[model samples]
Each structure stands twice: as structure tokens, then as C-alpha cells.
Target chain A: MVDVSQASGAEGPAISMRSRLSPYALPIFLIALIAVSGIVSPAFLSTSNISNMLLQVAPLGIVVIGQAFVIILRGLDLSVSSVMATAAVIATGFSGQNSDVLSILLIAVGIGIATGLVNGWLVTKRSVSPFLATLATMIVLQGFRFAYTQGAPSGNVPPLFRLIGSATWHGVPYNMMLLVVLAIVFGVVLAKSRFGREVYITGGSPTTARLLGINADRVTIIGYVISGALAAIAGLVLSGYVGIVDNWVGRGFELDSIVAAVMGGISLSGGQGGILGGLFGAAILVVVFNAVLLFGLPVQLQIIIKGMVIVLAAAFYVRRRI
Target chain B: MTALAPIRLSSRLRANQGVLVVAALLVILLIFGAFISDRFRTTSNILNIFEQSTGLALVSLGQTLAILTGGIDLSVGSMISLLSTLTSGLIAGKVSMVLPVAIGILLLGLLIGICNGLLIIWLRVHPLIVTLGMSAVLQGIVLLYSLGPAGSVPPSFNFLAYGKVLGLPIGAVFILVLFLLVALFLRYARLGRYIYAVGDDEVGARLMGLPRARVMLTVYGFSGFCCGLTAIYLTSRFSVGQPYTGLNYTLASITPVVVGGTLLSGGKGGVFGTLLGVYLVSLINNVLNFMDVSTHYQLIAQGLIVIAAVSIYVEKKKRV
Candidate 1:
């Protein structure tokens, strides 16, 4: 409604314009990193290298899109990484080397819906904090994965998955194409739809949203379900790319998604930013990771650097807001 | 007068509800354990539970402090990992080096905690993000320090875990002493009450002239100190310096605090409650072991218990 827009207008056009420019920082930084990478390694900008980087970023970007939606509702999906892992295990374990891709996909989606519903129920119906509820879901799901696998998950990802995960069409990775389509669809929905507007209103203030007749609980639950489903899709794609599944399949993704979302200008407090910003953030992260690999640094050093970058990015954004 | 009496009784129950719930859960678990296994009632088994609970108890003490101030420290697990790796690498079976190594590890913990506190307060970053980032950094540092499981602690260091003092394991005795000291401090100290006040309502506490930033710093720093202590125990118990030794410790530590009936939202929990929580979890694990149930079931149970416990507390608060 115009009420929300009118309320935001009181902040003045200058502030709004500044916020508009703020989202570009991540993409600019990504470009600078890419330039630096090319200088460090002449082959870094090669088509093969670039395509590989895109492939790496695709799954994360998809997951961050989902994370963005949840953050917009002032909630965090800490269970995302675990959900991804579960999906990967389920997809492979269910297919059982026979490559029953359709059933595997169905089961993965079903798991996502079920986990999301549980999270939503705990948070909404039971009145548990989102952080704790998602955290509990993460732990339980992780345990379920271990129990199902009994410490070792067996089975290979089907060829159909491999095609979507790793295959390219005319020099463009299928994964990247999928990401672009998803990004556009989500971006349009978030930017133009009434549901998206309701999400923003809820994130800004649940009480205010409820007073305006928005079903804040329903919006919040839907946001979580979308996040869970996307995370599962990303996991499925990752499984296909790796062609194997393991306990540590999606390790660090939860943190990485948060970092990327935040870096992309998605406010941690919620009700700000967009899908494009999250995509840029994911791209920047993948680029930095690619650069680190090219520099011949140890994996430990890469993690240390990534951690420092997250802290620094957060600090920078906080300072800018002030 | 009759209505007043009922109201008073309900109010009294509400005031002590967290403690009562935890106590009831502990009793139920004990009864369940005794009914299920002969080993559960044995003196040695009970002592073993206490011994196993010592590390978690210490970590939960720190977590209780942090949560009391309405913040969290996800880096505690990583802090334990770093401390243990450093201590074992430095001590390397040298009894003479224990004091200095221990001091060094604790100091690092203090430094890490201070950094977290300062960043959260000065930079105005959320404690969750800062601590999560710090956890990653600490993990990376641990991995860098030791690529694999390396370093052996001295036989004397093992005494911390294996030693018996006055018919009790030394670790359990230490835990009890620390718990009592913290309980007394929370009951009597100015800063302790300030932590509760701040967590309950930060702005109100600020307006009341409480040193808000200082309280936050001290809680986080103390939490780090606890992690250092936990690291010492873990290293002693495991006898190895592994990079990933305390991978689940952060969540494990938090679970007991919440299960002990501390509101994750903060301001209403104590070290004693956390101790009860630690024991409850340790007892559950012990019972599961005795019952020959898979460890995964324990994980599922723990997750469910935290959700259930927090839900009950929320429901009760709503009623009140």
C-alpha cells in the first residue's frame, strides 16, 4: 500500500538515492577483484576459467537468493547448510545409482517442505526464536543425515543431475543459466509482486504489518519455505557437480550465504536489499575464492581470509550506515 | 484472602519455574536411567557422568554469562580448538611448560573475547555475525597451526581429567568450585546484577547509569576464559592436539544453557541452571550409551529437548 511507501518517503530522497548507490559497491568490488586476479594470473580471465568460476558461484548464488528472502523477513535460516547436505544425500541415496532422477527430485523437495514447515511451526506456533528453531532444525537434520547414512552415504549422482550441474550449452554453463532464470523470476517477484511488498512490510515491523492487515506469520512461513526449497535445489545441483555426496558436502554454506547476503547490502536486521545484490555478493565471494586458489595459497589461508573479509565487510557497512 | 493465596502460590511457582523444570527433568532422567540399566546407579558411572560434564559445565558457565547479556559467542568452540592445539603443541609432554602454556592459552582467549566485545559494541555489528566470523577465523588459525592431529600432552596434564581428589574426580571438584564461585558472584556482585539488568532492558539499564559496555566486555572476556579452561580439560581428556576436537562445542554449550531453562532472549538464567543442564545432557548421553542406542539418536534427542524446553518456558512466560 501507499502507506508504507509514504512512511519511507519521510527519510528524504537523498537518503534513498544513497541507498540505491550502496548496493553497487559489492559488484564494483567484484570487478576490482577480477581485474586483480587477471593481473596476478593472465589466464584468470580466460573463458574456461571464467566459466568454471561461474559454475562455482551458481549454487551459492541460488542459495543466497533464498537467504535474501528470509533476511528480508527479519529471520535467518541457519539450517540452510544442513538442509543442503540432507538434500544432496537424499537425492543420491534415494536414486541408489539407478538414477531415478524424478523421484529423487520429488523426495528432495518433500524434505525441504517438511523441514521448512517444522521450522515455521516452531517459530510461529510454538513461539521459539527463529535462530534457535533453525538451529535445532540444523542439528536434527544433521543427525538424521548421519543416521541415514550410518557415517557413510553410498550412491552416485545420476547423469541427468550431472548435466544440469556441470554441463554447458554453447560455452554457458547450464547451472549459470538456471541461476539467471531463477534470479530473474525471484527478482521480479520480489520487486513487483504484492507478496514481496508484504514481506518487506513484515520485515520492517511485524506489529505494523499485522496492523495493516498483512498476515505476518504466513509471510514469514512462506519466506522460510522458499529458503529451504532453494537451499535444497542448490544442494542437488552441488551433488550433481561433485558427482558424490558426503557429510561435509555443504559445510560452511550457512555462514557463506549470510556473508554474501550481507555483503550484497542485504541488511542483517532485515527489510532491505534485493536478489541482484545477493547475486553480486555471491559472485564476489566466488571470485575471491577463485583468486585465492590461483594464488597457490593453502585452504586454511583461504578460510582465514574469507573470515576476515566477512568481518571487514560487515564493519564497513555498519560504519557507512552510521 | 483465598484468591490471594492461590495467586501468591502461582506467582511463587512462576518465579522458580526454570529451576523447577530443570530439577524435574533431572529427576525424571535419573529415574529413567536407573530403571533402564544397572550401570546407571553405580558410583563410578555417576562420577564418570560428572567428569564428562565438566568441560560442558565450564563452557555453559561462560555461555550463561554471554546469554545473560543478550549476546552469544559462537567462537567458543573454535577458541577451545585453538587453545587445545596451542597447549598441546607447546606443552608437548613437557611437565615444566604447563604453567606458561596455560597462561598463554588463557590470555589468547581473553584477547579473542575482548576483540569480539569491542567489535560488537564499537562497530555496532551484531554479536552473532562478529562471533560467527571469529569462529571461522579461529578455525582457520587452528588448521594452520596444525594440519593434522599433532602434539602429545604430558602425563601430568592427564591428571586434570583422570586424577581423583578426596574420593571425587579432580575435574568435577573444580567444576563445583567454579560453579559455586560464579553463583555467589551473580548473587552478590554489582556487575553480575548489571548483566541481568542490561539483558532485560538495555536502554533502561543505560538510563540507570550502569556501565553497559564494560559489562558486555567482561562477560565476553569471561566466556573466553571459560573456553580456555574447557580447552585444557578437553586436551587432557583426549591427550592429543587435534584441529577439530571441539567442533560441536559451541552448539553443545548453548544447548545446555537453553535446556537448563535460560531464555535465549537472555536476562533470566544462572550458572546453577546451566550446571543442571550440563548434567542432564551428560546423563542422557550416558543412558543412550548404556542402552546401546546409536549416537545419532542422542543428537536428535538433544535437538528435540532444546526446542521442547524453550517452548515450555515460552508458554509459561505467556501465562504469567
Candidate 2:
């Protein structure tokens, strides 16, 4: 519907430039940001600092993998942050010695999957928009958390959680290693699997996908399920890193995951970007957040910067697509 | 062709079903509320419900316009938070500054909306992202400006919310007048119809040579203005501005719009239905408060209503 004022002859360079730089843009930008930060605060890139950053980023990266799948399927999951928080709270609530780690893990993932199922069912079967469905779920979950916690949450992040989340091997945090392994596995799942291609097709063109016998609804639901499961895992990782359970835990990671996925080249409108890009986006965010903390800036700056990142990334990725 | 009249009648019933449902539910709630609680059916209590609903009603009107045009404004809550803070901070309890501060904050709200619209157009990004980002920016600004209850309004300024006109709260009166005006505009005005047309079918509206950019700008700008108005009322009610004052309005505003029968997909909803939705939600909350029974199951009742309402409409659309 837009009027193209320029002639075809004049529009060639911009198109070529986008193709050449878009994929590598986040990494290049990450490096540039690192170099600036390293110069400004030489301690920012120190070995210990890097490991700390990795530990902090693992939770976000884990969630980003899930978020990328949902975005790739042309859906948004607002309930992810809620899921993350709920999982953490429930995991920590079992303060008794009788509770095993495996049971807690199962319960956390079960919460995520159940939420994903509800979200998926709403979007796919009941015909609710993904945004609204997830938003409603988020609200319900928030209310649930409030009712359960009554504004004051009790319980500690288990020692096992803290150990898995913060412990390192040869200066590499365990959570970071988990994130890397999960990313590779899911990345391969997304790029090479039949389900992965189906997700892309459904997002890119539901009609075409339907014609090709892809169960679009089933695929979309699975995407939500994956998002839910990963977000739950992310929640535990976050609680471990923080070493506590509180109402505020995992509150804003939904936006961060969206920003990360979108920044990493996962298209907001769907059917684009990849797992590696999401990881890179998470890297960029962690570095930015680390730098902000390093500067002793107010946390409010992080909120403002996050908004700017979403807008800028949307501009970079979405503007050219049309 | 021969059966057109009956089909048209049925379709019209179906079309207006959301408002009818919400209206019926509102009536049912009033009845249930009155039956259960001694204080429920009094005129003052009922009027109080309407007064309390003014913020939601005002904000939802703007949300209705946005959703009606196949978009959303997630920044309304944050804008309210920012504007309310700016209002009290700028006025600083000076009665003389209230006029200027009010005008400035209202304009700022409109400016925020226009910025959201412009960014959407410029970046060719979805409204969700633009407004979500704007929401964060506004939230951050408000936090930086004030972490807690920041400033106070003069006693005289409280009239916006607390003043009574013919036994009705002034704020509710404003809602009546504004809702009626917006409803009329939607029914008769060109831009109003264009809003529906745009939301109903963007491609068709573009092909019809409608000013798509201008339409989006006006829709968002009005939404922002409504938020500004709501913030003012909120500030008047509370007598002080706090950073978190408007945070809940973002979701609260959307609920009324959808519950009143507006489609999230845009194009088929109205201000009156949204108004009814607002009243219904307020009454539900009031009744819940009266009962004092917390439904862990009940906690989700609101979200469930939104989901259920949206599902009904969306399912109907799919079948058609």
C-alpha cells in the first residue's frame, strides 16, 4: 500500500547492503560494544567478570531459545516471565528436606508445559490470538502468585539450584555450559528437524503450510510447549543465580527474551532468525546490562535501554522485510 | 435474496451480542451484589461503582479505537504513570500551576501516542512492539522521576474526580459525555468510519485511498489523550502521583474493550460496549471484594472472562 517514490534503479544498494550485513550485524555490534566497554572498564572483560556475565546471561539465553521458537511461529508468549517466576517460586517453596531435586524439576517443567498447553489450546483450538491468550495466562498466573505469596514470598533457592546455576568448570559457569548445550540441541532441532521446518512454514505462510499438509495448529502448540518448558528451566537458573525467591524474580525477562530474540535476527513477525542469533542477542544484552551495572547507573537505565533496543531491532529487521 | 430480512436480523443480533452479554452480566452482577450485601443496591454505592470505573472507561475508549483500527497501544498504562507523575511534580501543590501542568501533560500524552504511531509507520513494525517499547521507556522515565509518591495536588484540584454533579461523580459524568461523543463520532464521522474500515480491512481501506498514516496517528493520539485524562482523574482521586499508579491500567483497559465485544483482530467493536464492559468489570471486583472469598480459582476469573469472551468472538469469526 505504500507509495514507492524511488525508481527501481535507485533502490539497489540498500537492498544489497541489508542482505550482506543483517545476519552478522548483532555479533559485530556485540564485539564493538565489548571493545568499548573493555576500554572504559578494563575489569569488564576480566576472566572472573566474563564468567559472572555468563552465569547471569544463562537464564536469559535459555528463555530466548523458547522465545525464538514462539516468534518463529508468529506467536508471542507474555506468560513466559510469569511461568519463569511461578516455576522458581514453586521450586523454592518445597523447603522441606523430603523434596528431591528431580521432583522439583518435574514440577517446574510441568507448570511450564501446562501453561503452554493452555496457551496453545487457546491460540490453536479456541482461536484466541497468541498475544491475548498469553497475556490472559500471565494475568491469571500473576494473580495466582500474589495469592500464594501474599506479597511476601518465603523459601530459599535450594543449594543444588545455586550449585548448578553458579558453579563453574575451569572458569566457565555451569549454567552457561547448560545454555550452550541446550542452544546447540534446540538449534539443531529448529534448523534440521521436520517440526522445525513446519514451524517456519506455519509462521511464514499458514495457508501454504496447510495446503502442504502441515498440522499448523499442532505445530504452533508445540512451539508454545517448547517455550514454556525452556522458560521454566530459565526460571530455576535465574533463581539459582539470585539465590533467593521473591515476588520480583523473573519479572521483566519476557521483554528481555523478546528483545534478545528479535535482536538476534529472529523476526518479530515470524519465520526468520535462528538459535545462534538468539544466543548472540542474549550475549549483547548481558554485556549491555553488565556495562550498565558496572557504570553504577540506576536500574531504570536498563529499562529505558531495553525499550530502545526493541524499537531499534524492529527497525533493523522488520523495516527491510516489507 | 428472499431470506435476507431474517438473516440480517440474526446477524445483527449476533453482532451486538457482546454488548448484550456484558450488559446482561452487569445487570446480573448488580442483582447478585444487591441480594448478597446490604450496601449493594444503594444509589450512592452504584454511583460509586460508576465513579470508580471512570478511569477504566476513559482508557478503554481509546483502546477501543486502537483495537478497532487493527492495532493496540500498550503504552497507555505507562503513559498514565508518566503523566500523573509529571502532573503532580510540575504543579508541586501550586493551585495556579494546575492549569498549565494539566494542559502540558495532556499534550505530552498525545505526543507519546503520535510518537508510537510514527515509529510504527517509519519502522514498518507492529504496533505491539512499538507500544511495548514505549511502555518501557515511559515506565523508566517515571521511575527515574519518582520512585514513590512524589507530589500533591491542591484541594481545589480534587473536584475532577470527587466533585458531585446532580448526585453523580464528575468523573462518571465526563465518561458519559465522552462516551456518547465518541459513540456518535463512530456512527457518523468520516474518520470514525475510516477507523472501522481500516481495522476491518487495511488492504481495502488503502485501495479506497484512505489516509492510513493519518488514521493511525489520530487513533493512537486519541488513545494517549484519554490516558492523560484518566491520569488526571487518578491524580485528583489520590491527591498524589506515584510511579506505579497507572501500571495496571495497561491490562485493565484492554479487558473492558474485549469483554464489551470488540475483536482483538480489530474492526468490529464499539464504545458503548466497551463502557458496559468497564462497568461489568468494576462491579465484578466490587462484588468479589464484598464476598471476601478468594478463589485461587477466583483469582483467574477475570483473565478467564477475557479469554472466554475473546474465544467466543474469535470462534464466531472463524465459523463465518
Candidate 3:
């Protein structure tokens, strides 16, 4: 996407260098973290450990991709966690031993689309603030899950899910491969598609985008629907990984995705950054967690470090922008 | 003259619509509650509702201030958890340690507030993300301090929650007094006006040469202080320092603020509306309890209520 002429035309080499450097920063940081972890404990560099970490972070990476889209539209889906839980609950609760897994997946996707439509209608039609609207949806969905499951979810995730969730091929995790393929597809769509350009324009300025004849409202709704569907996919994967369903499933995924997206340099203000940034951000967070584990620190310390990283990255970005 | 009078009256009514809506809702709910259950109107039950609302009232007050300045403080809940644990740990059932513990907690609150304000002002980050990060940090700190509930509160502290003053619950009285003080400050203080101005239009307020950073800092600091006060009350009521006591306070506090008719985008609404909002929520919970409805329904109801309230309020504002 970088054109040498455009880089040299207006902003000069300094701005171009910064722009070029920013996208690669997360991957470099991930490598550095991996090196540090390997130095701390050589076992961290083992193939098994690396594969395991990839499997664990794959779901988060998927969710982060979805979050990146919504955030690019200058909106947020605080309901993602609840949406994930609802999807998992629906998938398992409806699917019996003889039930078809494909139909269950379809049902999950339907629920995601319905929830996204509700969120979109509230934001686009009713003019509600995205934060409050999504939060309200989150709370309502949580209650719905509780009422539906009656405090405990039943039925087991299908074996197909298990295969996808935990199986590997030639030393690479299937889930990780799924994440990589999805990431590439989304990255291409964001970089080379008209819809992606419209998203950037709409987020940059709704009025301007509308003036340019872009269907801002339609775009926003579609963005939310995509986010919902992706979140449900993540939920499906997570349910398979855990092998059971509960109301608390995907409890913190929303915040985790947001953190990863922000750390990847996706502007919260929207209209900038890409899915690749989100993937890199998710990878960095996973590596950090792996490093923390290798260090044998308490889980609480991991939380503390994660919080510090968010604040520090935000501060750094703010300073750089200024 | 007659034409001007109607116009003025309509404008005044529009200005007070939030309080009016919440007050009307409260009255209707109260009447419905009384009709549904004989115990709903009992003196003890009414007092209990008021007492239970005190913590939320304090937290909402802080939230209102932050929101008025076009910001939010998600960390208030976590601050409550941390302050409660820290104060209760220090108290350990000793009345002599209350003063020092309380001061320490308040100072810590102020320090957190300062950090939040400086980061937002200097680094210029979105308040939502900043506060979210702060909440996570505070959660970690609380976890580090105590894995679970710990420490016993002094009896003197208990009086703040359970004591009676002039035949009314002390907690209710405290909330009323605090409400009046905040109302007066918002009505009369220069800083309060500046807050509204900044929230209404940051560029305009800056052009007017208002001390934007200081106003933001004071707003956050005041919010932190409210959290500290809430921590004390919660600790007393529970009789122990619970690490997760304030887990729901963040959302709960926001509910009242939004339901009270305060614009989420800021620059409108008042603490008076918040008072009515708090009572409205408390009454709803009380009624649900009386009707034997599960708490799960209440959660759903709260969510619907927030969405409905914000939608109606924003639509009204737009029309005006």
C-alpha cells in the first residue's frame, strides 16, 4: 500500500520512515519478547511450547480481527464477551449427540447477526453512544444467557469442534492455521477492497463520507454484523477448546481484543490501521503471557504487567502523534 | 408578555426534564410497589431501600462529575475495592486506626485520580481506554493485596452504615447532605460552570482561557474521593474488606447517571436528577424482591432501562 511517490511528495522521508516502522513494530517486539523468554528459560523456545502458545492465542487473534473492524468504524462492541458466551451456550445447548454441527454453527452465526443488528440499530438509528448501547446489550445478553441456561449450560461441544480446536498437522496447530488464513483474508480485504476504503473514510468523518455518497449507515451496520459473526466464530473455537459451556465463557475476550487492537496501533479514533496490526498485537500479547509463565511469576503479576503495557503503549502512541 | 412567559416556562421545563422524568418514574414505581406488596410501604423497608442506595449514590455522584467533564471513571469500582481492602486491613477492628486509615485511603484515591488526569491531559488519550487500563491496574493491585475477602472493620465504622440519625438511617442522611453540598457547588461554584463549559465545547472553553487541565484534574480527584467514601460505607455494611465487593459498582453507578438523564456526551443534567435516579433503581430492586422475581430479571431490566433512557434523552436533546 505504500507508494514511494506519495511518501516523498508531501511528508518527506522522516514521516515515511515512521509510518513504515510503526506497522512492523509489534512483530519486532514479539520477536524480542520471544528471545527474552528463551533466554530466561530455554524450554520456552521448544517447538511444543511455541505451538501451544499459538493454539491458545488463535481465538484471541480472531476476536481482535473483528474488534479492529468495529473500532475502525469509530465504534466498539462491548457486547462481544456476552455475544461469545451466548453463541457458545446456544451451540452446545442446542446441539445434542445426534445433532448436526453445521446447523448449530449456522444458529450461532444467526444469533451473532441478530445481536449485531440490535447494536447497529441502537447506534445508527437511535443515535445512542456506542459504549452505553453496547454495554446495555452486554448486560441484557448476560441475563439472557443466565435465564436460558438456568445458571448452567449443558451438552458437549461436537467432536468436529474438538478436532478443529486441539488437533495439529505436521507440527502446526489447526486452530493457528485457521487464524493465519483468516488474518490473510481480512488483511487483503482491508487493504485492497472498496468496502475497506469506505470504512476508513466513514470513520475519518461521517459527514464527509456521506457527502461523498457513501452509505455510512449501511456500512456501519455491516461492520457490526461482521464483528458479531467473527466473535461467534471465536466463541465456537473457545467452546471447543474448553469442551464445555458456561455463562462465564468468553468473560474477558472483549477487553482483551480491544487491548490487542490498540497495542497493534489501530487508532481507537478509527479510520487508520489494519487487521495485520491487530494480528501482530495479539501475537505480542500472547508472547508476553508466555514469557510471564516461563518466568514462573504469579498470574496476578501477569495482569499487572498487561495493564502496564496497555497504559504505556497508549502513552507512547499519544506522544508520537503529538 | 404572555407569549414570553410561555416561552420561558417551556425552556425551564426543558432544562429540568431529566429530574422531572426520573421523579415521575420514581413516584409511579413507588405506588406500584406499595400496591403489589404490603411490606413495600413499611417504614423499615423504605429506610432499608434508602440505606442500600447510599453506596450507589456516592459512586454515581463521582461518575456524574466525571461525565460532566466529558470523561468517565471506570476505575471507581476498582478504587472502591482497593480502598476498602486497604482501610479495612489497616483498621483490623481497632477504632484508633480509623483516622489514619481513612486519610491513607483518600490520599491513595487522589493519587490515582492524579495519575488518570495527567495521563489524559498530557498524553491526550481517550478517557475510556485510560480508565479501562486504570481499572485493570487497580484490579491487579487489589488482587496482590488480598486473594479474597480479608480484614475486619471497626465497630465505629459500622455506625456509619447501620446507625440512625433523628429516626432516619445514618447512611441516607449522609447521602442527602452530600447531595445538597454537591448541588450547591454545581449551582454556584466557578469551577462547576467551567466543567459544563468544557464538556459542552472543549475548543470554545479553551479559547475562553479556562484552566481545562485543572478542571479535569479536580473532577477526577473529586470522583476518586467519592470512591474512597463508598469504600468506607461498603466495608462497614459488609463488616469486612472484600476484594471483589465493587465488582458491579462500575456499571451500577453508570446506570443511575444515564437513567438520571445526564447526557453521556456530557454538558447536561445534574445531581438532583441523579438522586431521583438512585431512588428509582433502589425502588425497582426492592419491588422485584417483594414480587419474588429473580435477580437475573433485574439485570435484564436494568440493561433495558439504560438503553431506553439514553435513547429517549438523546433524542430529546437533538430535537431541542
Candidate 4:
């Protein structure tokens, strides 16, 4: 890592060097994981295997995008798992034949927005704590999923839906393409947009943001809305990829998203992290996840590893945690 | 300063703010229950409420202390489940082994709590993340230990949960006594007061020369201990220890704590309001069951109640 202190100082030689690797430092770890996975099982490096991993990463990566935003605001959304499940169920249950895909996607996104709005409203207007508020939504949503699914959730994903999950064009996975597009768009929005700057300001220091006339509540609400909408998209993608409607689908993504965000160097203390960094985090986590699967580790042990990662990553990266 | 101290001190109690609200809710629930069914009005059924709520009451006590210190122990649910499986698996229906095993489980819980405290302090991470991570690790351990209910306790041990003292459930009565003692300790004790001080302002509390590390460690330890007690009680009640025993507890425990008027930001809540909160939750469940509501809807109802109660509490706190 380039020493920021020296690099930013009058060291003429260092001043010209842009440490691109230092920024997305996670890539080195990602490369090492790929190398190890390939060595452990030669088939792991196969294009098919790599694409399969990307398919898994896509939904989780999108969810991480949303989770990263919330983390940037020093808030949490335990409701994402429920939100994701609800979205997936709504899409397949309501779609019936998968005609008019826009409507189903819209409805799913609508649920996400409404859920996010309620969460934000409760936190800002009603003064409920972020985690508890979302947790309530999570509970209510779980019941809703139970009630809605009945025995089996309605309908199946359309063949066209596989375009995003499985179909590839020019040797690139479609889901990866969509994810790349999302990363660029949202990444730019977070890094360059006025709203993004406001997010950082409000999150980093509410008092200072207030002095600067930023509406912290508005930023918080919008952040949640984006998170909710993105979570819905991720859920829809997951459900579509699975091609079935099950209540347990996307069950633990809330925690996964947090882990990804933390791994991506998104500080829980707020006002840091970017979309690209989060994607890297998502990629790293998914690679590790695939490694666990390839090694045939039990689900129980996978859970232990995940928990350990969240703790270790947060301890390493989250400044001002105390 | 002396003249205002008691008033200010009383105001600082978390349970005071929502004591009346939860009490009022309980009264309304009781009346509603009475009107709803003859089954609900019976003394046996009334006692049943306390008995069923004992598990939550025990778990929430530890949660209360954790929240009081401006941190939360998400591990308690997993701890409860893990300890339950261990307590039952180790005892294995042997009377001679029960005492030793139960004590060992409680000590293990304490050890986990201390580990949580050490991790938070050493790593300089919030307890939420540390405990959350620990919860996952413990949950995996539970799953690895048993896919289902693993073992049983002797019939004689069942009395811990089922036995009554003067018509009240043993678990409920004992838990009530425990709550009262903790309330008194929080009110009259120095260490107890330090909990509130740390929650209200950690830096200020440290500047006051309080032992913040000891306070954090002990609070988490108490939370773990409470989970241990709950596990034993659950094993006694169910006769078998299950992996999913405390599945809903992590979230369920917080409902009573926050609705009891404890701020999520920590500080300013007491166990008394939590006692009322427990009763209120029990009453709500009882009323719902009497109404023949689906168990699925019961989750929604509980969650809705949490949201409503929290909103009202937040409004009340802000006004103050």
C-alpha cells in the first residue's frame, strides 16, 4: 500500500504514482483464492465453474451494493433477507407465466421501496433503532412469506429469465454483464453524484452535515430506498436463477451482504466505501464461498467461517468502532 | 443537587418510562382475554401464561443488562440453544450427572460471555459485530452437535420447570424472584449504577474513573448466565433439548427490552419495565391464541406490537 501520508506529501517520485492496486487491494486475495481453488481442483478454473461462481456472486453482489450504502450511513438492514425472499416469491408467484416481466420486477421493486420507506420513516420519524426497525420488518415479512407461499410459491421463472443467470453472449456471462452495468452506474452515482457526497457528509458527521445544511434524514431515507430497491433486484435475480419459488431462498443474504460489505472495506462507522470496492468484496466472498463448497465442507462449518470473516474483517477495517 | 437526585435517578430507570404503557397494554390484554374465552379466564390458564413466558423472561434479563451497557449480545439465542443441547446431551437422563453438567454449562456460557467481552475490547469492535459473529459460530456448533433433540433429563429434574410453589409455576416464581433481586441490585449497587453510566456516556463514565472494562465484561457475562438458566429451564420443560429451541429468541428478546423502554442506544432502562414487558408479551400471545389466530400471524402480531411500542416509546423519550 502506498503510504498516503508520504504519497500526499511533497515526495516528488511518489506523487506521480497512482496505486491502483492499493485501492482495490482485495483483488490480490481474490487472485490467491482462485489460484488455490484451481490447484485444489483443476476443474475449478474451468470457464463453466468460473461462470457458476459469477452467477452466485451476481445476486449477492447486488445485495452487497445495497448493504454497503446502508453501512455507509451507519445503519443496518436485517430486513434484506425477508425483502429478498418476498421479492423472489412475488415475482414467481405473481408472474404466473412470466409474461410482462417489467410488471413483476416493478412490483418486487415496489415492495422493496415501500419496505425501505417504512424502515427509514420508522428510524427517522418514529426514532426506532435501525437494526430493530428492520428486524421488525424482517419478522413481519417472514410471516408474509409464510402466508403467501402457502404450500408452494406460485409459478416458475420464464425461460427468458435465464438470460441473466445462465445465458452468455460473446463468452461473458449475462448476469456478470448486468452486474458490471450496475457497478458502473451505481458506482459512479456513489462516487461522483451530489446525493452520494451528501451521504458521506451526513454519515461521517451528522453535526457537521447539519451545519452545512444537509438534510440527514432525507439522505438516510433515500439511502434505505436504494438499499431496498437493490435488494429486491438481487432477490429477483436469485429467484430467477433458481427457477423456483421457495420460502428459504435468499434466507441468509442479509448477513452475507454485511459480510461482503465489511470485507469490501466498507466501514460500519459510516461515510466510506464505494460500489467497486463492494463488488470486490462480493467477489472475494463468493470465491471463498465456492471454495468451501468445492472442498465439501459442511454447512455448519461454512457458517462458522462466515461468522469468523465478519468479525475478523470488521476488526481489521472498521475505524472508530469503539 | 441532593433535592433533585432521587427524581433524576428515578427518571433514569428504563422500566419507568414504559412501565405504565406496558402495564396498560397488559390490562387491556387481560380484559380482552377475559372477554374472549372461558378458557382464558381459568386460573390454570392464567398460570400457564407465566410458565410459558419464563423462558423469555430469563433470556430478556441478560439482554436487559447487555443493552444497559450500550451493547447487545446477539449470541444469547445461540448460547441458549447450544447450552440446552449440551445440558441435555451431557446429562443423558442420568441423575448423578445433571448437577455437574448444568453447572458446567453455566460456566461455559460465562466463558463465552467473557470471550465476547475480550474480543470487543481487544479488537475495538462493537459488541454487536463480535457477538453476532460468535452467534454464528455457536449456531454452527449447535447444528454440528445435533440435527434434532439430542438427549433428555431425568423426570425429577422436570420439577424445576413444572413444579409449583403455592399454585404458581416454579420457573415463573423463581424467575420473578430473580428479577426482583436484580432490580434491587441495579437500584442500590455501585457496579449496577456504573452500567447506566457507561451506557449513557462511555467517555464520561471512564473519566469518572469507573472500571468500564470490568463493567462491559460482567454485563455480557450476566447476559450469558441468564441464557444458561433459560437453557436449563427449557430442557426441563420440554424434556429434550432441540437445536431450534432459541431460534426466534435473539430478535424476540430485544422486543421486550426495547418495548420495556430501554433505549437501543443503551442506558436509561431498568428490569422492572422489562418484567412488565415480559408479561405484556405473554398476555399478547395468550390473547392471540385464545382468538385462534394462526401461529404465522402471531409472528406478525408480535412484530407489529414491537414496532408500535417502540414508536410510542421513542416519541415519549423525545418529548422528555
Candidates in order have lDDT scores of: 0.84, 0.86, 0.83, 0.83
**DockQ per candidate:** 0.53, 0.55, 0.54, 0.56
Q: Model 4: per-residue lDDT, tens digit, B1-320?
A: 89999888887554465777678778888888899899999999989999999999999999999988888889988899999999899899999999899899899988888889889888888888999899989998999999899888899989998899888899888988999999998888999999999988888888889998888899888888888999999999999898888889998898898778887777778898788888888888888888988888888988898899788877322110
Instruction: Identify the candidate with maximal lDDT.
Output: 2
Which ranges of candidate 3 are over 4 A from the true structure? Answer: A1-17, A95-98, A319-322, B1-5, B315-320
With candidate 2 superimposed using the best TM-score fit, by how many Å does residue A305's alpha carbon deviate from the native?
1.2
User: What TM-score goes with each of the models?
Assistant: 0.96, 0.95, 0.95, 0.93
**In every candidate, what fraction of the native interface contacts is reproduced?**
0.61, 0.71, 0.59, 0.70
Better of 1 and 4 by DockQ: 4
CAPRI tier of model 3:
medium
Q: On residues A1-322, what C-alpha lDDT tens digit does candidate 2 reach at each position?
A: 1111222124367665775676778778999999999999999989989888888889999999999999988888899999999988887788623346788899989989999999999998988878889999998987888788887788777788888888998888989889989999999898888888888878766777888898999999999999999999999888888877887689999899999998888887677778899889999999998999887899899999999999988888763542
How many clashing residue pairs appear in each of the predictions shown? Answer: 0, 1, 0, 4
What is candidate 3's CA lDDT for residue B48? 95
Grade the docking of candidate 1: medium
Model 3 C-alpha lDDT per residue in residues B1-320, reported as the tens digit of each score:
98799899999999888788888888899899889989888999999999999999999998998888778888888889988988788898888888888888888888888888887887788777788888888888899899988778767788888999899999899899999999899889999889898877777888899999998898888888899889988988888887788988988999898888777777888888888889999989999899998878889998998888877876432210
TM-score, structure 3 vs. true: 0.95
lDDT score, candidate 3, position B175: 91
Q: Top TM-score: which candidate number?
A: 1
